[model samples]
Target: MQVNLRFFASLREALGAQRQLELPEGATVAQARQTLIDLGDPYASVLAADRAVRAALNQQVCEGGAILSHGDELAFFPPVTGG
Candidate 1:
């Protein structure tokens, strides 16, 4: 299955604004992240399991366990804080 990926904030600076990704059927958000990390370098560092990252599915906040479907949009960004 193919899904759209959006990166925001620092993640955007690191991985670009957005890109299309191909994932196995039934892949979860966490798995998609892991796939990116598996590519090594910046991805492995930026999206590392030790780091804090937030995700959204189809513009709605979602958990790592969220199942992804074809044409779904997934976004990753650093936690936000406002004064």
Candidate 2:
């Protein structure tokens, strides 16, 4: 299945660019992230355990275990902060 993966704000810089990913059936958001980590250093560094990373699957917030299908749009971003 093909999914559109977008990284925003700090994540964009960290990931280098937004990319289209072809993943296996039922891939989860966490699985996609792990693939990014395996890509190399910057991704691993950015996604390292910090607890603030956020992900939205199909425009809805979802746990890492959420199942995904073809044509899904998964987005990753830093926590929203406003004052």
Candidate 3:
């Protein structure tokens, strides 16, 4: 299955605004993230397991366990803080 990926904030700086990713059927958000991590370099570093990243599915905040559908939009961004 293919899904849309969006990167935001510092993540955007590292991975670009968005791209298409091909994942196995029934893949979860966490699996997608791991797939990216497996690509090595910046992805492995920026989306590392220890990092505090946030995710959204189809524009709604979702957990790593969220199942992804073909053409679904998955976004990743660093945690936000406002004063």
Give the number of the best model, judged by TM-score.
3
Q: What is the TM-score of each candidate against the true structure?
A: 0.96, 0.85, 0.97
**Residue-wise C-alpha lDDT for candidate 2, range 1-83, written one tens digit per residue:** 99988888988887755788888998888898887777778878887666478999988988788888899998988989899
Please list the residue runs of candidate 2 whose C-alpha ends up more than 4 Å from where it truly belongs after superposition: none
Q: How close is candidate 3 to the true structure, as a TM-score?
A: 0.97
Which tens-of-lDDT digit does each residue in 1-83 have in candidate 1? 99999999999999999999999999999999999999997899999999999999999999999999999999999999999
Superposition TM-score, candidate 2 onto the true structure: 0.85
Give per-residue CA lDDT, model 3, range 1-83, as digits (tens): 99999999999999999999999999999999999999998999999999999999999999999999999999999999999
Q: Give candidate 1's error at residue 67 in angstroms.
A: 0.3
Ordering by TM-score = 3, 1, 2
Backbone clashes in model 1, listed as residue pairs: none
Q: Please report the candidate that would top lDDT against the real structure.
A: 3
Query: Model 2: which residue pairs collide?
Result: none
lDDT of 3 at 45: 98
Query: How much is 32 displaced in model 3, in angstroms?
Result: 0.2
Sorted on lDDT, best first, the list reads: 3, 1, 2
